[model samples]
Target chain A: MNIYNKVYFVLLFITLISYLGGFGKKPRYVRMVILLMILWFFTSAVAIYLVKYGGLTNNLFVFHISTPLEYVILSMLFRDVIVNKAIKRIILLSVPFFVALSVLFSVFIQPVDTNNSNIIIIESVILVFISLFFLREILLLQQVTVLHRFPMFWICVGILFYYTGNLVIEGMLNYMIRQSMELARRTYRFGYIFKYLLFILFIIGAFCSKSPRLLTKKEQ
Target chain B: MIISVTVVLLILLFFIVSFLFIYKNRQVRHRAEMESVKEKYNQEILKTQLEIREQTMKNISEEIHDNVGQVLSLVVLSLSAIELNDTTKAAAKIESTTKLVEKVVSDLRNLSKTLDADNVANVGLVAIIKFELELLEKTGVYRTLFRLSGTEKKLNGSKEIVLYRIIQESLNNIIKHAKATMIKISLDFSDTQLQVEITDDGKGFDAGDSGEKNMHRSGAGIKNMKKRANLIGGSLAVKSVPSMGTTVSMIIPFSPAG
Candidate 1:
């Protein structure tokens, strides 16, 4: 396998480990999100492999099928962390709006057969804001003695890095594709590798204790 | 240009993440330190309370053995000496025995009241101190004087308990160690503070003699008294000179916490 394929497969392995490790321990929403990520990774890996070897153009449709689900799961994961009632309501309302917008934009504006830069950028922005807000609330409200060991802290860090880096690359993807396909492919693969490397953080988060209180183990 | 911008953005992201990590680390450490201090203070308060309870129990045992036991032994002696045939003398003996039994009952009632820890808490500080002085004076060894001035305002229950213990400890020390003839206690209430002074005409230890060697031996009692005072946001001063009296003065600010 190429380095890109190796990286992608490593991420898949890690996500599977994280999903299984989170069983009974992590919050229900976290487990659900990890399960969805595992499915997305497995399907995307298979689709990419098939497209490269069998010369099938229809494999890209798997991404189209998974993208909306990913957005909804990401929003679900964040709803537990956000404290403000109004902000939480907005996030809860945005999931349906995001799904509807993605459908309309893919059908009429960007087409289902190609990469949807508009939806990708919107998703990145929303996910990034959620991550940032989670970090802000953690510092403001939590009496965290050890920051890195906290499960939510690791999750926020992972989301922030992945979405912020993805925002820059994904926003310019269409233009890069038109100008130079090789350069565009290289940039996309670089982003993909970076994104998977950061999933190590999610695995770390899954292994880490998710208690927000300092006296959790002490109380027990 | 795109490469440069990505590099700059990535650097900015790294900085932001690093700064947050450092900030969180500092905050958590500070909170942990504060929690440790709080835990230590609570432990001290608990220890002092337990010690006071143990001391009170010891005093109660002594009181019962010395005072109540002697009175009851007298009643037994009076009952054993009854002459049934001499009716006039028997009636007078019976009347005297009844009076002695009633006095014993009153003493037992007073002792039981002192045993109640809740009573000590709810009782005003001045009343508690005055009761202690009365008990001391009843012993007939030390001449006790209590002086109270200014309109007294009540402190919180726990603070009163602590302050009362501090004074009680000093009196016990005087009774045990000082061969003093007179013990005087004064409580003065100002607009913003309450001051207490207890002085004894006992053979006093030298104040300058509390060197490092004597700290654990001679100064532990004073340290304990000061600690209890500090727990109630009060200050304690001990002054003593050889052949002169020892005096303990505590100044507590009037606050809702007390």
Candidate 2:
């Protein structure tokens, strides 16, 4: 790590200490902090792995599978207390979300020929699901206070972009019906870039959580 | 271009992650400070109230010790001469002294009861207000009527204490200055708001025209009532109509307030 990267770790180390402190004392609240600390650990681990191992190609396995698995775990964590029922419904809809994610990895199975019709269908279905989820979250729970809404919003956008980009990747690499690298793939690269932005937003927004008291207490 | 885009993306990601870490820590610090402030505020209010109650009780205690105790002692000393040879006059004097002592004892008991509250369980807002009504009735100065409408649930200790103090202070103001006939106290609670209205058929004052120096001479008991209301995220308003009496209204609204 460089100087700035080293500085980030120092902040990470302090967060780790706070997280450790959380186990012992019960303030009015500390769950949000503990959740952030876990995210930091994973994030720092990713940075370290990138520095140590080199290339997305070398570790495509974890790079692909882990994110969808993380979302599934999150869906469970925010299970019932999520006031926004649509978020839960979207999480269920993401059954296809992870399946489409797995399809992207399966496409790598035929790495020599990336143009496959099944990959296009899977990616398209995911994009549709993501757009629907985003619209529902925005419309239904825009004002509802909850623990998961912020992170869920960004996750919706990220999935949308990830699916859209991967769809284009499948079309270009697998389909040779027409091939012009610069002209055909502009939107695809843009989508991939946008997905990264959404991922960063998701991680940061998770820090804005409050405790879940949705069904247990009547909100006035 | 890819290298530049990649570099920028990595930099942005780093900053967002860094900000998230700092923000989380900042929240912890802010929450800790808020709790201490709340606790400290609770302590300060408790201390002030203790001082005031202690001062009032001490004054009453001293009055009883000096005046009532001395009278009773004199009666006891006079009655000790039971063997006074002049049977008729001596017996009569003894009987008078005994009655004097009994009167003093009753007055002493009233002094203790007059200060308020038998115990912690009895001093809540509802209980204290009911006591004020009974005391007003005994005075025959003005009949005090009380109407309470609420479950009295979710009234935490801090809220209860502050409210009880406010009502006590306001009623004290009415009895002392507002030469009124009847005082009506109503404490109404709803989901969104809690309201207390104390109205009297006494000589009222102009709400706007504050005779501050005069009020200072008499002690700003009304100002203290207002301060108590303000402390609990509420307001106190006193309205008067010359010979028509005065009404003091206190309103406290719970959060997500409208």
Backbone clash count, each prediction separately: 1, 6
- Scoring the B chain of model 2 against the true B chain gives a TM-score of 0.69
Model 1 bad stretches (over 4 Å): A1-3, A18-30, A49-61, A80-94, A107-109, A141-144, A178-183, A203-220, B1-25, B36-114, B118-258
- The whole-model C-alpha lDDT of candidate 2 against the native structure comes to 0.58
Docking class of 1: incorrect
Question: lDDT tens digits, residues A1-220, model 1?
Answer: 5777777777767766765762356675577656667766766677877788878866656666677888888887788667778878989999999999999988898787788778888998999998888887767655565666677777777778788878989887888999999989877876864466467767777677655445342321
Poorest lDDT segment (10 consecutive residues) of candidate 2 chain A: A211-220
Give one digit per residue, the lDDT tens place, for model 2 in A97-139: 6666565655565331233345345545655454555444444
- Model 2: runs farther than 4 Å from truth? A1-181, A193-220, B1-5, B32-36, B58-83, B86-106, B114-122, B133-142, B150-154, B191-193, B209-224, B253-258
First chain of model 2: TM-score?
0.43
In candidate 2, residue A22 scores what lDDT?
Answer: 27
